[model samples]
Target: MRETLLLLGARRLQVPAIHVARKMGIRVVAIDPSPDAPGLALADCGYVYDLADKKQCLDIAERERVNGVMTLAADFPTPMAAFIAQQLKLPGISPRTALLSTNKRHMRAALSDANVPCPISISARSLDEAIHAMKSIGGPVIFKPAVSQGGRGITRLEPEESLNSIKSAYEHASNATRGDGILVEEFVDGPEYSVEALTWDGLTTVVAVTEKLTSGYPHYVEIGHSQPPTCSTYDVEQLSRTASSGVAALGIDWSASHSEIRLTCMGPRVMEIGARLGGGYINTHLVPLSTNVDIVGAAIEIALGRKPKIEISLKNKAAAIRFLVAKPGIIQSISGIEDVKNLTSFNDIDIFVNPGDRVLPLSDADGRLGYVICTGENSKSAIEAAETAKSLISIKTV
Candidate 1:
């Protein structure tokens, strides 16, 4: 008899994990608030309840008697996954660690105490406190919600920006967070990268490094990413070391972690760590294409208490995904998608909005109109393929 796994969240991001579990003959029961969750169709059972609702998920997990619980990419499900695992005595990261990984202040303090390099940060609750933090941390800082994701409510503060600007940004951060607080950190100037790793039995395996591209300024949103990252060997080792330290600090074991780090003149400084796979199709699409490692399958196997074989089946291949952005208006028409799909390196394209749907400015990730995933012999070729595919497509607005 196959062991049952309780999967948290049923968005398209969860589809890869569901498919992997089924391929391993593991019975999957998924939970999500969306009735039309794409992953639901692939599950042995699915419950239409908020993945963050601990009571609903626990009730279902009890009924199913699931042997394991897992979620990927989605932040809301990380703590819930830990909660369910704790309730059922399953293999997973601790609830405390999961909670720490989600909150900015808590995560920063934990990493700092562990001697991990990170930005100078302070948590502020009021406008007065934020002002004091800004003065202390100096200007050219970034403020982010204590609990938020997808770059929502992230603001950059320059020396010339008005004090009221930070005040409004403080309100934005507070509104985005479940708690009424935010962390202000001195902005590190350098290239940003993401470190993907898996931990089993207290040993961390650094999988791949991904170079991140994001919209700059007050409201930054990830636009594209490529792997393996183009960086020096020393930078890779430093990033991996910092990520491992962060994972250890968070007490993450038997789990996969996605950590963001900015390489400064000093070295790699960790921005934050997520106790799950990197989102934006990094693990599901990029990692597999770049390294020939099925991270989703490995995560599932680890959740099932199985020893997953970790190996580099391929090297030197590059994979990338570029998101489509449109002006803030009703889309009149979209063309060239069919033509772009015929490109040699085109993996897939997903258009989120239709002709009649209104496109919002690139404030948050929700503004993404579509995306293209591609793989090539090298990072340059992969990025070129994605860019070419993007250039061919057109979203007209009026």
Candidate 2:
């Protein structure tokens, strides 16, 4: 059987790819360090291996003679994906560009040097250097791991906060990384949106523009996302253009790209770019529902050296997804999903956690319990439905 190698099989984004590949009659070989990864259950064959170990992934891919090797949602695994593809002579992006996408500092340097509109960034290996860099960059800066994903180890340090606290946050972020390095950048205060695009032969085709709503204060966790972003047509045009330029600058070819950008007063500044599908099921569920674009299928096609069939079948409607979060503690029970599904505006609800599972407060991707997806004729209606669905679900903790 022809096989496709999927790295980081536990990730939510990989689930859709596995489903799509299976439907297309392609066997999936899932690899991850975690044995309990959700995607393992659906894969035709599963292997437990650290995704960061490029040699192991390459060996397995070669052994299986996998047609393609790819990852969804996670940037750290891109390097491994590229390495496997390169070793197996499969279709994938170059290792240099994949490395650029994985490392924020390197990505920023490449984009900025190419004259792409990205925020100025600096790297610090220690807390002292991070503090000094923060002072030099001025206050209200965003500190994050140089090579992390899902908003882990990201903290916005305001000028009013104590230096000691800022240093602690930097240390915490650095310590969380596989490597002891942090990235500090000037916080571009503006509305944020993400552009999902697929590139073929160096030409980027914009798939969808997603407006991201996040908890504005201490934690920048994403609370919700709505498609056909509620921004002006002018802003949308700018975002698309900027995303295209950024993707080209990174030299990505025949790959799916998810880029986050802020509409700053100066113009659109790229927050970060990932050389993979969007997490939180944005590409899998939300994009298809909102734009009639089969992003998952397109990603698989691109990986297989096929041109994606991009079409805008669904129009004049919006779709939104809201994540359910709770205070830090063990989950006792969850109720109201049935009640939520019964609502007039309800569309779909997925719960990722079960009773007795310990839950953490919303800080990173892992903290989210589940998501409520809703659709409406317009963006406002979609957002309202999503919010209403969120309100219906109640999480109880002990």
Candidate 3:
């Protein structure tokens, strides 16, 4: 009999994972808050429920008699998946680990206790506390919500900034968190990278290192990513060690983890770890393109309490994804999309906006209008192809 898997978050980002699980002969029960979510259509059964509501999702899972539950590339769903898995005694990340991974304050404490290299951070609930944190940290610091995603409500405060600046940033962070506490930490300056891994039976395997490209400014939004970063073997090993240590520190026993690390002058310091696949098409496009690892299929198997095949089938090629961002206003038209798509080097092009749709300024990851994924003989070539495709396509907004 085919086992039923409870899949959370039926957004477009999760469609690939749902399709992969169904292809593996596993029945997928997808749930999301929106009834019209695209991925829900791919599941054997669909439910309209908030993914953050653990109790409801658990009840549904129980009624369905699901073998396991899991989520991919989402924030709220990860903890919910953990809760359901624990209730059913299934294979997944521990609920305690899920909470620690979702909250920045708790995650930092755990990492610091484990002697993991990361920024010194403190949690604050008010502007006065934030000011005190800035004074204590004694350097340029970043204000982030303890619980938020996609770089939403993240602000960097300079050393010479005034109280008003702190207050504004604090307010923004608080709003994004919906009054939840905020995390103020010393800003680590350096190149940032994302590590993808899968943990099975308490053992973590570092799958790939992704070089992250962000628009450097007041708000850091990921603009592009290339797999198998051009780094020395020693650096890769160091990053892998850091990622493994972080997973161990967070107590992620059986699940996929996305760890973000910054290579600073002092050394490599972990920024944050998401208890799911790395978003931005890294798992669906880049990781497999660079490492030949079937992360989605493996995740499905892991959720079903099966040991996944972890062999690297190909490591000679590379892949990259470049996001398309538009200026603030209404999208008048898009041109040269077909031209860019016709390029043999490009793998896929996804446009999220259309003419007459309102477009916001590039402040967060949600501001992306579309993206282009490309593969090449090497990382450098793949990156070049991504850049060329983005340049070739023009989004005209007024």
Candidate 4:
């Protein structure tokens, strides 16, 4: 008998997982707030319900008698999905671990308790506390909602920034949080990387080391990623070890994990961790394109309590994704899309806005115009190809 798998999100990022589940002969039950979510049409059955409503999703899971529950590219659904899995005795992380992973403060505490190497962090619910936390750190720092996603409400501050700036950053984080409090932490300066891995019980197997490029300060929203970053073999090994330790510290079991690491002057320190596969199409495209490992499918297997096949079918290949951005204005025209598609290295390109549409300032990931994915013989070439693809596409705005 085919098992029913409950997907806690129906957004574009979760669509690939839905497709993978259906291909594995699993029944997909997707839930989302929007009736027109792209993944809804692909699922065997989809419910129009808020994923944050744990009781409602639990009811649906019970009604469907789902054998597994999971989510990707989202944090809101982590706790609920884990709670449902715990209630149903399905294979997944514990509800406590889910809370620890979703809330940045709790996660920092857990990592600290486990002696995992990470930056000093503090939770601040009010502006006064935030100011104090910054002073305590006594240097450059980061302010963000404890439960933020898509890089929303995250700001970096220099040590010399004024009180007004701190207050504004506090308000930004507080408003974006909606519920979770604010967190202030020492800003580690170094190259950033995300380790994509699968776990069974307490063991973690790394599949990809993704090098992250971001829009430099006040906001560090990701701009691009290259799988198997152009680093020495030792650097990759260190990143994998640090990220693996973070997964263990978070008590994540029977799931896919994406752990962000910073190679600091002292050593490799974990920045954050997720109890699901990565977002920004990293799992859906870049991972598979580079290593031939279907991470989304592996995530499904883990959700089903099966030992996922994590072996890399290919090696020495690489993939990259670069976001498209434009100056804030009304777009007049877009060019080079056809040219981008014709490129030998081109894998895919998606443009969100058209002529006469407004392109807002890039505050976070949501503000991105679109993205281009490309392949290469190695990470360097892959990144260069992605850059070339971005340059070819011109967005003229007024």
User: Best-fitting candidate, measured by lDDT?
Assistant: 4
TM-score of each: 0.97, 0.95, 0.98, 0.98
Cα lDDT tens digits for candidate 1, 22-64: 8989999999899999988789998899777889899999999
- The lDDT per prediction is 0.88, 0.84, 0.89, 0.90
Tell me which of candidates 3 and 4 scores higher on lDDT: 4
Tens-place lDDT digits, model 3, residues 260-309: 99988898999899888888999988887788898988988888899998
Q: Between prediction 1 and prediction 4, which has the larger TM-score?
A: 4
The regions of model 2 sitting more than 4 angstroms off are 1-8, 314-316
- Candidate 1's C-alpha runs over 4 A off are none
Candidate 2 per-residue lDDT, tens place, 1-398, comes to: 56564545555557778888888777888887888887877788888888878778777888877888788777777888888778777788999999888888789999998898977688898877887888788868888888788778878888677878887788767865666499888888889899999998888999899999987766588878999799899999999999999998888886999999999999999988888888887898889988988888888888877788899765546899999988778888899988888877677899988888888767777788899999899889999999989988888888
Candidate 4: what lDDT?
A: 0.90
Ranking of all candidate structures by their lDDT, best first: 4, 3, 1, 2
Clashing pairs in 2: none
Query: Positional deviation of 1 in candidate 1, in angstroms?
Result: 0.9
TM-score of candidate 2 relative to the true fold: 0.95
Q: Model 3 lDDT vs. the true structure? A: 0.89
Q: Which residue pairs in candidate 3 have backbone atoms (N, alpha carbon, C) closer than 3 angstroms, thus clashing?
A: none
